[model samples]
Target: MAVSRPTILIPSFNTGPLLLETVEAALATGYPVRVVIDGSTDGSETLLEDLTATDNQLRVHILPQNQGKGAAVLFGLEKSLEDGFTHALAMDADGQHPADSVTAFLELSSRHPEAAIFGRPVFDDSAPALRVNGRKISNFWANLETLGWGIDDSLFGMRLYPIRKLIETLEETRFARRFDFDPEVAVRLAWKGVPIVNLPTPVRYIDPEDGGVSQFRYLRDNTLLTWMHFRLMIGFLIRSPWLGMRGENPLLHLSPPAR
Candidate 1:
């Protein structure tokens, strides 16, 4: 089956030189790429603007101020949908996500157009133990919320989202606008009965000296995730009967495409 090429949607905030490298790598896949600059004050806007001027396949959108990762991603997804794209592959701007796996992920999404393709990170030694272990806690809660619907890694930011379903899922609540994006979206999509496809991809934590910039605030983001999961638990319980019935037919509750 012939599938449309997905737009590469990247949400960036103050990620310095790494954003440039990430964009270049994404463009290498020969797919249309759209980037949302989340009020970056780090001079990345000028750099991206220049690139957009040169490449017709690359488009950049700027937010007036820093909203959050999910907000920026929503902006890009909305714009891509308006432009007639059906799917978007979202990756971070900090260069941790493997660019080499872009083709494989896109291919899988093309084959399984109704499913969300999530990257199951194979972290190298460069990954910090603290962050790695902390994700386990989030993953556990995510599984419980979805009743073991098979989301491999809830916090990994690299994934291919079916634009219509993702936008529909996100519109149900405004809580997924920040660091809670990855996990919240996964659980919500699962609740909507979207099939999950986990693909193994290598992840590397680049050092600062290598132009890697990390915006993860250990205390702040984790606290945000804690609240997010708390709210999801309530939602899960409220939807338990609906969820149980939908289990008999996984495609029973999918939202209609956005108009």
Candidate 2:
């Protein structure tokens, strides 16, 4: 059996100062943390200069140009694989995801090493109503596309994935390399019959005064998601028969890991 070496992965694109804070918190979890600088022009990667030099636990990879969140994550995953990591917990560089919850998620992944462990966000008042409500639409479609598979939150970025499974899933598709990454990956993983594990983690929307940088563009991103679901829906239709046999709670099946 291959031993699991799980790492916290933060993909940043012009995330400004929050990138440093996020990396620091992740490093504090005592797990190796990898940051992918996705062609960020804001020089945000510079913020981690000191730590990267001093800390062996933190490693940063830079892309020549911005390639979207999904691309950044894919880059990180490839590096993680090369570095012998078996799993990656992906979180946004923005301050929304809680750093303290990293240990719990990794611990859970340790026990259920073959499952995709998702963070079901417990939102505070800081969460924007539109963003909160918008995700419900994505969640609904995600569940439907998976034939009612258990997916607590489809668009949550803070999720743990078995590195190889996730890479194989991404390699089979090209559409999820941008804003559609989160939801699309979740739905596709379900179709592949990976077990679902959801844990409630508190999420905060950092105020602008606190140096929060949001890259989300409502119309552009939403249209991308709509198209993504449309494609997924078609794929789901073709595979529903197999997916249906996976049962309501696929985790209970717990098939042996891939060779």
Best by lDDT: 2
lDDT of 2: 0.89
Give Cα distance to truth, residue 127, candidate 1, Å.
0.3
* Model 1 CA lDDT for position 235: 95
Candidate 2 deviant stretches above 4 angstroms:
252-259
Tens digits of lDDT, candidate 1, 11-69: 99999888989999999888999999999998887777777889999999999999999
Q: How many backbone clashes does candidate 1 have?
A: 0
In angstroms, give how far residue 84 of model 2 lies from its true place. 0.5
lDDT of each: 0.87, 0.89
Cα displacement (angstroms), candidate 1, residue 108, comes to 0.5
Model 2 agreement with the true structure over 1-259: per-residue lDDT tens digits: 3777999999999989999889998898889999999999988888999999999999999999889999999999999999999999999999889888998888888888888988888888999999998898888899899886778888889999999999999999987999899999999888888888888889999988989889999999999999998999899899988877777754634322211
